[model samples]
Target: MLLCPYNILHKAERRKLLHAIGRCLFSSWDSPVYFSDVVLADIFTSFAQVVGDVWLSLCMLLPGHSILKPHTGVGSRWILPTVMSLPYLIRLRQCVIEYNHQGNTHRRPLYNALKYASAFPAIYLSAAQGMVVGEGGAAATWFGGSHIFRLWLLAGMVNSLYSFWWDVTNDWGLDLLRPRSEAKKSESLRSPPRRLVLPGLHSATPHILQGSSSIDVHDPEGISRSVVELSVRKRCHALGLRHSLHFPLLVYPFVIFLNLVLRLTWSMKLFSVVNVNSHAGIANFCLKMAELFRRWMWVFIRVEWEMIKKSRESHTKHRADDGIDEYELIPSATIERTPN
Candidate 1:
């Protein structure tokens, strides 16, 4: 928390900064929930990283204990995964709380919780691998046909794919699997999915703000259905166009590619084949740096997606106030609101 820039800001400034950060992390600016729950998860992860770094520093500073070697002992083998899993456990609990408290009509909250739950198997499997190698040594563990190695590989793959899918679909709002017609229907039928528009593209403000007859002050119901229809059409197309909204088009794809690569290999830190504490701890340093970069990209895209979603929701609400039945715009599901 000391490292976050929010510490230096005045109360008002801090509120603004926290709101933005909350959107990125939790997709909502519900202050109590964001500060108490979402921020707690992030803080736990930061502390875990700090603990790992401190451990590495100790390994380097006090070398007589053989702390720099692989299989340093039971404590060293288990500590990393234990610390790393703490944040996920916190997040998983939060998801369950939200699902129960708010009522899970769509089961979206449960699905989000499941994504966090997936991390545990990979994390523990890595620790198990380290423990096995400590007991049997690398030769027997790797070449002795140990099932742990293959099991760990399979667990890592499943965890990586699950996390990556959540990142792109739920977090980033890129429904890559749904067909184009499905995307169009989703956009038109329900309120537009919360999404960001590309930086260079036209603004995604509500039609009323753009000089469209979405609202006539004297007769708000006189809103042109055609105008609303056109707005929805543009928003549907903008979902794909906005992939590179904050950065250049090329930058987003590269970031996405890097995200996938990092996700797949994140468990490398736990692999017993190569000692992360060896080579002057270069492997540990590199992995930490890569993770930081991946998170930076994730935060950027996530905040943009949240901002767009908020905008679209506000627009929809304004229309509702003007006597427009937003649900009538499309033929399918009605927009439902979940309590914060």
Candidate 2:
């Protein structure tokens, strides 16, 4: 039976393959679950759905109204992104409910707030795009240039699409919510942990040692070690924090790059054809999203750093038994002479 590729596979292997297939399919439609991945996906899908809905609404409400007309002053862009973000935020809130049940009261509420806040920028950006296009028409009426308006609309659409893709694929936060399959859990348990060493903040020597059991102690101070240090000391053998950076690379860089492009496009425009109200709204939204992104990134980095630091500290504690001082791992600038 082992020789048959389909029938011979163990139950665990079958489950793993099934999960992988599910992931591949899900990623094609929705963003892969990672920390913040869902938020990113929601931003894009929500914006697209909103824009489409608004377009349909405008077509029905004002059949004779031309989006290209100079008098409209750029209709609401906030409607689409805001509308889209709301459902996803609600869903995210539901996800957090699970955490709340686990006694993570602080984290549950905090995540809910952050998810809600994330939608604001997407809405604002959509609004800005709409306003910019509308104001360009106004500018065209006064300045006698239609080409600029066309270019602005084209660029805005391109930027919006770019933003949409960013949200669809970049979902780092979602992975945190997904439960690992039994096969994965078993494989993880079986594999040996990898180690990493990092430079000490105060010393020239490589001070961080991360590996299994190095920082697994219950002490609070030990929890402050960096992830790299802990990994080297084998403390994270059971924690599985050493996955490849594939998910982040697949999602965040694209969003960041797209936002940068949009910003650059805005900066390159010589005249302000974008409406003030719309621009302010979109800017505010982008600012909020950026702020949340930064905060999440900071927390992830800090946590990893703490894990490493704890492992190193644990190593130092062990060394103390062999006559090494706590300061030995961290070298001092001034040396004291020993008296005979």
Candidate 3:
């Protein structure tokens, strides 16, 4: 809701900026169906499953070799696929929850069955990919400076878990996914639920004996509909806050630091040169998985950001309407008139 200062820009340019930024900031807030919320559910989740399976296929090319490849048996062969399929598994669960409940009863079984079509492929492929990629030896064995290999591995694990939680909550509702203690701890941070009151409509017939407090009215249809919609909206607000992604207060920053430091220090050396050539297939599949996750995240983050913008805008508008001129709700494009 921060207004862009357009004093330097021409009127037309300012108008264009306002429109683009307004959209960038906020989209669907009151509506249950966010435009991009289901984008991953309908398409990308299944796509990732396919990519994972390809990796599995590549792993099959070299049988019985550990993820620690050149090292042979240091790490479990299944580690890579298990880590890789975390996102796919999370999405599959979300798909079941979101799509399975929609549409007619007869097609529900068909819809659920299709989730497996993607899920199984991704799981198998990831397992294969994990098994084939041999390790580059001990982190200290190769790079020697601080054993950064473990850092990258941990980062990957944490990021996947974080993303899984984000998808789960957004598809369902936040309150449904939140642990009870976490919910209680964060209770003071959320905005309070709005109260719904249709003022004069609720009590039209005053009871004189009850000091005009008790009353009844049953004549108007228009007022009744307003009451119903308002009730539903209020109930929604009370039910829960909107769900979206967030980094853990403490862990996210450290994860960022670790990624920057390790990637800078180890770079391509983290993966063995021989495996890079031998496991080109698995590498390609990993890229596909990364691409899939990046796209899914972009959708979730962008749309959720839009909602945040909208919510802020609504708040600012409310304040402005209440005569708080300190924060103007006026668009930047509106031209001010100067009398001659």
Candidate 4:
């Protein structure tokens, strides 16, 4: 496992190795396993689905076996919450550790930690509702819409909205919620980060460009200062969005809308309309599949955002040293290497 990192420099290869190491070693390595919201959330979601499938397989092996059914008994009541909340718990711990190590003057980590922590009340409260059995030995309806259910619903809404906001503004690197003037000034296309770090490690540190005026001082390759502003302005106008519009112009708004919709639909698991307590069934499986798909989309955009940020930082550094402000992203196959 240790050799995997030494020999394989690719993040994807290292991720496969880290998956075999399990959750216990998430934060142990010098380059800790990358656990973005998508990854950690997937851990809970995928694990739950796997466990459910395993139990279903067992049920298939021994027909008409009540004991083998997944999440059917009191024991499963606790198990559900543990699985659902474990990812959030891990992130919350990391946030706490970060805050303890580095003082919470800014309170970014603390606030972020609270966002993960919010999942607990909703998860546990939903599980608690299952404990109260109703007629025909089924989970009760929180005593016909009682306080606990209301509180859980409230928690779910808060968590969903907060998480969605963070996903857009923080995770996906889109300042969608900011005012139009500020958003345009800090166009995500123009301002790329100077450094890249894993999520939950640190708050976003934006390296804002020091206005179009500074471009003149840095231009050395006969590339006029107006070219920089023109490039950014043209791209910004083309994209018509305030994010890392690295993809097609319409993609930014499309993903944002889809993300918000999926987030709301995922939260439906908390509602009485969806039988979240039942781990086995078409409804449950469909919900998990939907969440899985949403997370897959999230991973794509999140990784792209990170890569673009890193690329911009590299470009910034190269420009500083080489006096080259503009560069093309050539195909990897087209690059010819010099012999050693």
Give the best candidate by TM-score.
Answer: 1
Q: Provide TM-scores for the models.
A: 0.64, 0.29, 0.32, 0.62
lDDT string for model 1 (1-340, tens) is 4236554546665676666545445653232344234544643453445555556566656646555453366567666676667667767766766677543467877898887787777767766765665565656454443676687788878767887877776677665645677665665644543221111123333333332434433343444553464566455446553322555556656777898998676544533323343333676677767877787777777777777787677876776566322223323223344334
Where does candidate 1 clash, by residue pair? 194-309
**Whole-model lDDT, candidate 2?**
0.41
* Model 3 deviation from the true structure expressed as Cα RMSD, one decimal place: 20.3
User: In order, what lDDT does every prediction score?
Assistant: 0.58, 0.41, 0.41, 0.57
Stretches off by above 4 angstroms in model 4 are: 1-15, 19-26, 29-76, 97-107, 133-145, 179-240, 270-280, 322-340
lDDT of 1: 0.58
Task: Kindly list the per-residue Cα lDDT of model 3 for residues 238-323, writing each as its tens digit.
Answer: 44433232433233234333333433222122222223234456665565455445454445544655576566567645644653
| Candidate 3, superposed: residue stretches over 4 Å from native | 1-153, 163-195, 201-275, 278-290, 293-297, 313-317, 320-340
- The TM-score of candidate 3 is 0.32
lDDT (tens digit, per residue) of candidate 2 on 202-308: 34443334333433334445556654443552432233333333234334445445445544343222112223223355764564465446435534543444454
Which TM-score value belongs to model 4?
A: 0.62
Query: Between candidates 2 and 4, which one is better according to lDDT?
Result: 4
Could you tally the backbone clashes for each prediction?
Answer: 1, 46, 9, 0
